[model samples]
Target: MRTGGGSMTTPVHNSPRTLVLSTKTWERELAAELVRLGHSPAKSRYVANKLLKRIVGRAGWQRQAFLVD
Candidate 1:
């Protein structure tokens, strides 16, 4: 039950993508948003990270908040 790194490394590289695609709600929402913004659905995860960073920056969430949250 670790959050990241250390002994929690994913054994299969495909696991992360599989997990994301398996989340129906998230995958659908991301695809819809990407279409709305004229970007490819393939870029959803990267775009999501960028958007989250922007939100945290604007809201002044500290570095620990960014990393731990």
Candidate 2:
């Protein structure tokens, strides 16, 4: 995992209220990213969870991680 210090890119179309509401991050940096991506914090959170679960679930070992030996 990144140490919350790496650089990320977001579109320049989103607003601060959106960033805060969607991303739910008190961190100014993260909120900035949410704006850059043109996503409300809520949109960011929703998209992140949706895509992440698919990626994680695609790994064969991921199922094992959710199950007992």
Model 2 whole-model lDDT (C-alpha atoms): 0.40
Clashes of each: 0, 7
Off by over 4 Å in 2: 1-35, 61-69
lDDT of 2 by residue, 1-69 (tens): 122342332223453222111122223434456667887875665565555456556764342222111
- Local lDDT at 51 for model 2: 50
Error of 2 at 53 (Å): 0.4
RMSD of 1: 10.6
- Candidate 1, residues 1-69, lDDT tens digits: the string is 222333323234454432211223333455567767888767876776566557657987642322221
Displacement of residue 21 (Cα, Å) in model 1 is 19
